[model samples]
Target: MVQQRTADRDGTQQKANHTPWLEWVASGIGLLLTLGIFGSIGWQAFDDAGAPPAIAVDVTRVVPVEGGYRVEFRARNSTGSTASQVEIEGKLAGDGAEAEIGHVVFDYIPGHSERKGGMFFTREPRQESLALRALGFADP
Candidate 1:
């Protein structure tokens, strides 16, 4: 126990209140931190609210799998918007034949990030005109 004592004029030692101002300082800091966090969240919510998701799909690699060929693709979200349920399609057309189409869906493609997926195709992707495209995406 810490107590501060003072002697009176009549030679009497009395106890004095000796409380530091730590609570006030801690409360002030907590309030400021709460306000700062809310401000940052508000800024981020409004900053990219209208920004569209510029999701692009690029074919990275192709390899022969069990049943057919596997085409690995990279889905890149260039804008500040996150994309969900991103649907990507790959088409192979060549030699006056019908185009073979394969598609895959990604769960999420975060803002300014990339996600990888693969699709299966019966035809050889390297020998044909391989085109990769992001069909559509849902806002996350």
Candidate 2:
């Protein structure tokens, strides 16, 4: 009987293809890794610190009293953390406004609260101006 033989170099056996699925699998994994990296950076940039903090601002009212409007606000910090600083700003609403109120700052510890006062106006601001509406907290 006669025997059949396959071709070989130097009369030795041939080697099979190694890592055939490596290229495809590696490409898919690389794509997923890039997407994950970008997603994490975007989420971090959008996250806010004082947003879910322990302090919050509560504006009670803006009434025309005591010769001018009295703006009352309450600061409550109950998230077990203290607010380092809080600021409040206001401006008169009218045409060609000249009066601009600056921000008011306060500090509070955890579980403690404070009330903001002396947000007074020298004269009655126009009710129709946008600035007036903003100071009145009517839009927000």
Candidate 3:
């Protein structure tokens, strides 16, 4: 915004002034917007930080592959915190056959979120004896 306007002696514009009306308004809006976003994020992080990750793993599906069985599983984190390097272990034991163990590692599971991965096993898993559980995890 121009605060002053002057005309030259020859009837041409010679002086112009800029007022920071728009600049101040824009800066205020930007500052408020940034504060709102960062404030919410900070509050959320503070609330969730004290909680630990509660994770569980379950076998969703088991299908036969060429050389082994593909066991698809789902890992869920039900707490307010996240888990990293989550280990899921699977055990398959059928009557008279030896127990076959398989494991899969999930990269990360966010709080109250789920992730899917697959493990390979030489023996097919039965629903009655198939065991799927969260072995361990690192805090993220």
In TM-score terms, which candidate is top? 3
lDDT of 1 by residue, 1-140 (tens): 12333334223422234434797799989999999999987987877656889988878888999888998889899887888998888889867899888878889988879998888888778844888999999977
TM-score of 3: 0.69
Q: Once model 1 is optimally superposed onto the true structure by TM-score, how far is the C-alpha of residue 64 displaced, in angstroms?
A: 1.9
Q: How do all models score by TM-score?
A: 0.63, 0.38, 0.69
What does the lDDT read for residue 41 in candidate 3? Answer: 77
Candidate 1 local lDDT, residue 13 = 22
Whole-model Cα lDDT per candidate? 0.82, 0.52, 0.83
Q: Give the TM-score of candidate 2.
A: 0.38
Please write out the lDDT profile of model 2 over residues 25-108, one tens digit for every residue.
999899999999999767655644224335455556667886676666566654432455455565655456576463555543
lDDT measured at residue 118 in model 2 versus the true structure, 0 to 100: 39
Cα error of candidate 2 at position 75, Å: 2.6
- Please identify model 2 stretches exceeding 4 Å from their true place: 1-55, 65-67, 109-118, 125-140
Q: lDDT at 60 for candidate 2?
A: 65
Off by over 4 Å in 1: 1-49
Please state every model's RMSD to the true fold in angstroms: 6.1, 14.5, 5.4
